[model samples]
Target: MEFKNVSVVKEANVYFDGKVTSRTVVFESGEKKTLGFMLEGDYKFNTDAEETMEILGGDMSVQLPGESEYTLYKKGESYVVPANASFEMTVDKYVDYCCSYKK
Candidate 1:
């Protein structure tokens, strides 16, 4: 997907020792999103706002809040994480994703 008339943060939001990295993108309406990629590994992330994660490329196994097991999400798929919740992800190799936060 392409973003138009938006501002992107130069510095990345790096996590898991750089295994996961994302760049913040700010829209004209003050909506914010992160475009990022994850290398092969397991990761846990906590959310302050509700988030919709769209898989841009590759795939991931995600365990959402209160979920007992991981569910596979492939390219062109998306998942939501509730506000103030945490989730886990397992990336097989590399997964490209876009995360949009609900205000």
Candidate 2:
């Protein structure tokens, strides 16, 4: 993967007291994605749009909205979060991820 004629946001979107941060990238066609890193911690997040998050490095345990169990996702694994729902993430080690927002 290569992106042509795209813009990268200089500032990162920081969350969880700087435990998680991501850089925004906008494609020429107007699609957007974020490349991020998360430190060891647990986080709760809510979404306005459906999102697909792919683990790129390390490991993650996620509990999606309405779920009672935490599922482990290693590198190269992906999970979907529905719009208007919230999820819980437990990161035991530093992790890298790519998050793509759906239309």
Q: Using lDDT as the measure, which candidate wins? A: 1
Counted clashes in each candidate structure: 0, 0
* Lowest-sum lDDT 10-residue window in model 1: 1-10
lDDT of 2 by residue, 1-103 (tens): 5666889999999998899999998987788889999999999889988999999899999999889999999998999999999999999988899999986
| Model 2 poorest 10 in a row by lDDT | 1-10
Q: Write model 1 residue lDDT over 1-103, tens digit each, in one string.
A: 5899999999999998999999999999999999999999999999999999999999999999999999999999999999999899999999999999998
User: What TM-score would each prediction reach against the true structure?
Assistant: 0.98, 0.94
Candidate 2: clashing pairs of residues? none
